[model samples]
Target chain A: MNADQLADVVAGVSDPEIDVGLRDLGVLRSVSLTDGRIRVHLTPTRLSCPAVGEIARRVRAALAEAAPGHGIEVVWERGAWQPAAVTAAGRDALRRGGYRVAGTAPRCPYCDSEDVEQAGRFGGAVCKVPYDCRGCGSTFDVIGTAGCNAMLPTPVRGGSR
Target chain B: MPHIPTDSDVYEVFAQSGHGTALSHVGSIVSPRPDAAWHLAKETYGRRDDLVKLWVVRRTDMIVSSAGDRDLLAAKTRMPYRQPGFPTARRRDRSAAPPAVAAPPERRDSGLTERRDDAREPRLTDLWLALADDLFVLGNRLGERIVDYIDLEEALAVGSIGQEALAHAGTILVLCGFDQPAVDARFFDRAQAQWQVSRVVERLTDWPSLVAGGLVIAAAVAVLAERTAEAEPGAEWLSAISAIRDEQLVHLDHWRRWARALAAWPETRTEFARAYAEVTECAGDMFGARPQSQGQGVPAAAPPAGPALAVTLHERLAVLVGDNGGPGSRLPDGPRTRTWGVGGSALADSLSRGRAIRDHYAPGVFS
Candidate 1:
């Protein structure tokens, strides 16, 4: 019905890991509409995160209802997502949701207990890692963004010894 | 043993405000403060007014987690097949462990090659081989010797060491961008090429030999892992190896405890030393034991100083293995009795074969 209201629809897409919306999480970089086509730019907290595809899908679905017959494209650029973009509320929500911002033991999202132990770093899923909450004796998944050793000491393919 | 960080990082001061109330935690704040604790409680739990007590605990204090008064980190995971008196490796289904988080595929071999082009020296391939091969061969031998133990605890320890060794080998393989089967085919399939590993297995077959081997291997790995952690504390390569290293240090402690236990018996200690003397020369080569020349096939390693870690590991391993009151106890055992005959011709052939491995790898080059 209106230009500004139609443009704000994709902002409602929430990050799967954290329950906060894209706009609130500061991942939604910019959204502009032109000639029945909407271009949305989003950024990821981690480059290797697999949730990028899911978030894009949610953006498309959210936009389909408001801007019918309009082509909506969600694009992500590396280095676009900044920690400063995350709102105060988003950070608080993440803490409340049992995820630590800095690399420390996270509180239990379920029991809200700080007595949580990291079970292992090799969390099988790309987005979430495995952690055991000792307080309630329950195991849960949290955002797994710890291992970022991108510049590995590469080996040259040499003949067998 | 539970891991204690070499340095204390932070203190999470909790102002209980009251006795029965909870303690609050925060990031590194070295100052004595009821005020900061007050703010943390207010921000995190919104319960500042309910406190009249305070507990300033060191960060490492929380690091030591306890389960029934025992350090949970030191607790041995009793693997069923690893249980003592188990006769064969075939009966034991090697468990599925936490898989390695390899660096992105594109960057795996390419990074080392690019770095090699700029710096024309062998990268730490020798160290990598030593670590990888030690883990692989030790794990295989340990698994094979599982029947030697009669006690449940000792057996479990043996199994745990072997299993963990295999798991670590996988990560080391991934990090080196080498295939496990390929490595197995290269070293494991052929006995002659296994100069570093065979020295241990060739002379010693009993459980005490396993203990001695376990002692040296675990100690070496622990030292290397600690050094690696210091070098790349927050790196991705460090990430996979670091986690494995933490637990491996526990395995090291477990083997040390076993070694200490075996040392209590004089007969067992003698057997251990007998086994030690056999593999002593090639012990340094445990990291990069291959006697072959480092041709163009080898990639350039940063900080190229022939296997410094190996030398350090060997020296540290000596201190550990020598602690059993056996003062200069590394008594030489006679000509290595082989599956083949112990005749003069056989002995002469074996001596030359062994010398080649020693000469190729170079004994004191690590320093």
Candidate 2:
């Protein structure tokens, strides 16, 4: 397979948890043919994330099948995965799947109501926070911005939206 | 008479929205007591947020670092090796064929190996072992008591703090040139008498005692780690040590907050004070001289002096329990001067318990 075909095969792998393609999720940092071998670099969402090992394994298996007899290497890059790295298409896909991406203003996922209150700074996962909607009377988890510094005190309106 | 809450009674509120999630700082509330603070936190934050757990610690109980100490609490340079991905990246690099062109020659002597004026001081290995063992022992003891905590939030916090201590211990062992298997053996199979842990960590019998004793030892360790990091700027492990010291500060803050909270309450006040006194009694010798092995002539380096470390510990303890007109005011002064060493039966018991758990799981064997 050519470089483009090889890249496509590598990008086909999806994150087990998020169910998004590696390329769309910004996990596929780079894919290049170096020294006649296929080398793929990936950056994890978090250093201690359990999905990293599985992702690497899947990537290796996918590449081996796509480009037979070619040596394949999956290199994990040393750096934090930034939420900003999410492609626009990836964001849209995530939203369609009922997942909120960080940096966007938080609203009720259920009713799309702007009148929301933060019920908890932490959610089921480290990257998410639980928010309650005054409109729908339901709580939903929103993917929080990457770091604690991003957690500014969001203003809450007294009246209905 | 019921005490009226005031601005001076500000409490920092932390909340967890789901089971097994860590509590994060949300905001602050002003209340006279912990119970009152919890109620106010729910009233203030629960209206909009869906909080399942909350922690209300008084602002006064926090140990804030000064602006000058920023470097001590953070890594000044990138430490790629510290990241989980580093080993994989390194392995890939090694497996790749060597570059066609020859690589540049390595430096003859990095500044790390150069002898300094304080060369006569004790080796970093000995100091690291002492610090690592202390944390390892404390981590095990704290972990053992996690299930005993009635409150889920407290139990989670204890488990997290314990895990952090163990991680720090492992990092220190790595710095001392021990691989993963070596670290496991040193942690689980080492003889009881060989442990260099301070006496303060060994006698934690109950919740109140754990809080008080943890506060004292955490303070001492934080101070010692900071001093070591400052003294050894050229050390290769500087960044790692700084990172560990930063987490040590967090541990210190947790213990400080709990110690103060327990002392302020009517129910736990007397018990907390008694635990504090008992721990401090034997804590004096915590910073004493490192004992030399038999027939080993001169010690490599002198341990941080007992009085100096004791003075720092005293000052910090004072900040926690000193001027407060509550039950803490009645507690004894900081650790007195004495020789402290590893516990005998306490160490044996803890080690045995750890071995039992390890055997039951039989690590490396899949069920």
Candidate 3:
């Protein structure tokens, strides 16, 4: 497949747990064709994240669905993981869907209220901390550091040279 | 139609305590609909003491580790030292004691202490003991009551009582820290009823006398069964009591088995008898003290050659003993006495009354 097609195919790997596109949680850093195989560089929200396996499997599945018989391998790196740095493209989609984009103060994902309070360290997911929007009176979880908690980053693997 | 989340769907539940605090894993919950899932999450995870807020997320959306490496965080080695075996155990004792004591002093001992590694063994043992004793006593009572009677109603009543007692005993055993998932229904079918009776037994402080009386009757029946085999060989009446004794023995053995749980829950003693009584009532109308009008009014005379005399004698004895308000009857020209004592003046009156009943019935048969 062409590099552009592969990029889109790679981008299709969403966060395995949230079902949100990888481009949204910002883990899809880059997609390039090095040698014969396609390489996708990926980072999770945390290094010791629990959902890394699931994320990797979903990525493989997405790739296979896009291009049947496509060989995929996932290499997860702990560094370059930041919940705040979700990509612009991904951020726009998440924002359009009424989810607060990563980075900046996490406004209540539910009400988009900046006037929020920390409800608890634990949220709906392992890495997400629940926050209450003072303005909207709703509670939502902010994805916390990955590899550190249950939340893992978007799935990506290096191309076979 | 709202979609119900299958087990595969994972929801990220977030609990908020107050403001700006981090949420921790209180627990996990499963459900179908997002809204319904949220409620289920709250019930299962939030019902516990730790949780205040809950979040539900479909599992499909969440990222997770592979099944192969799920135990990476699991403690592989003994970390006793991390909790209590530190080298500075002495030094920390001085510095940490006051603050540890100060932080939620009420909770320090009652809550955290319960979770500590040290207290669990003793606490579990205490619970086990209480459960065992409670079941054991109840089992003894049940075994003594089980009897197969000639009359269908009486047999059914006895069977129900036995079943209820065993049920209570079995559950008590299971709950006494035994990890069994289910109880043998044959052993204790009417446990709820037995528990009610147990409550009453606990309240009646004079229960020892009643229990002792029951035990004595059981023993006497056992003796009579043994004698039946030896004397008047193959007498059906004696065999009947023997069969009843066998059932009673089984009940006793089962109780012996479950005594551990009974000992664990001492507080339950007060309520068990009352529960048992309620259960018994549900099983059937109790055979409790029926007015003389209701019981078999001295069954009609049997043929002369039949062993009716002995049966009539016993029935008469039972009626006479039952009459005079349980052993305090004034016999003509005889000394007044309590009825239960062996060979007491009351016994003489009972014997005479029984003989009179036999003669009176025998003439009717002849006539």
Give the TM-score of each candidate.
Answer: 0.39, 0.52, 0.27
Candidate 3 lDDT over residue span A7-109, tens digit each:
6776777776665677667777666665555567676564324576677777777777776665565655333556656766666665555455334566765
The lowest-lDDT stretch of 10 consecutive residues in candidate 2 chain B is: B291-300
Clashing residue pair totals per candidate (backbone < 3 A): 13, 7, 92
How do the residues A29-55 of candidate 2 rate in per-residue lDDT, one tens digit apiece? 888886679988886653324466689
Q: Which stretches of candidate 1 lie over 4 Å from their true place?
A: A1-161, B1-123, B147-150, B180-184, B187-191, B194-198, B230-234, B266-269, B276-284, B287-301, B307-313, B320-367
Model 1 interface CAPRI class: incorrect
Global CA lDDT of candidate 2, please? 0.61
Candidate 2 segments exceeding 4 Å error = A1-161, B1-120, B123-126, B216-250, B280-341, B344-346, B362-367
lDDT of 3 by residue, B1-367 (tens): 2233455745667776645666755556556566787877777666755554556667666656555664774678955444544535634553453321111112112111111122122221222222222333443433333331234333333343334333333333342323232232212221221111212123212222223222222222233233333444433233222333343333332222222232235764334334323322221101111111111101112122112322332343233322311222121222111111122221222223333454577444422
Candidate 1's residue-wise lDDT over A23-120, tens digit each?
76777888777787888878665433457768988888888887788888776643344445667777677766655442344567778787766553
TM-score ranking, high to low: 2, 1, 3
Measured against the true chain A, the candidates' chain A TM-scores are 0.63, 0.79, 0.72
lDDT of 3: 0.40
Q: Give per-residue CA lDDT, model 2, range B19-44, as digits (tens).
A: 87888998887787776878888889
Model 2 docking tier (incorrect/acceptable/medium/high):
incorrect
Query: What is the docking quality class of candidate 3?
Result: incorrect
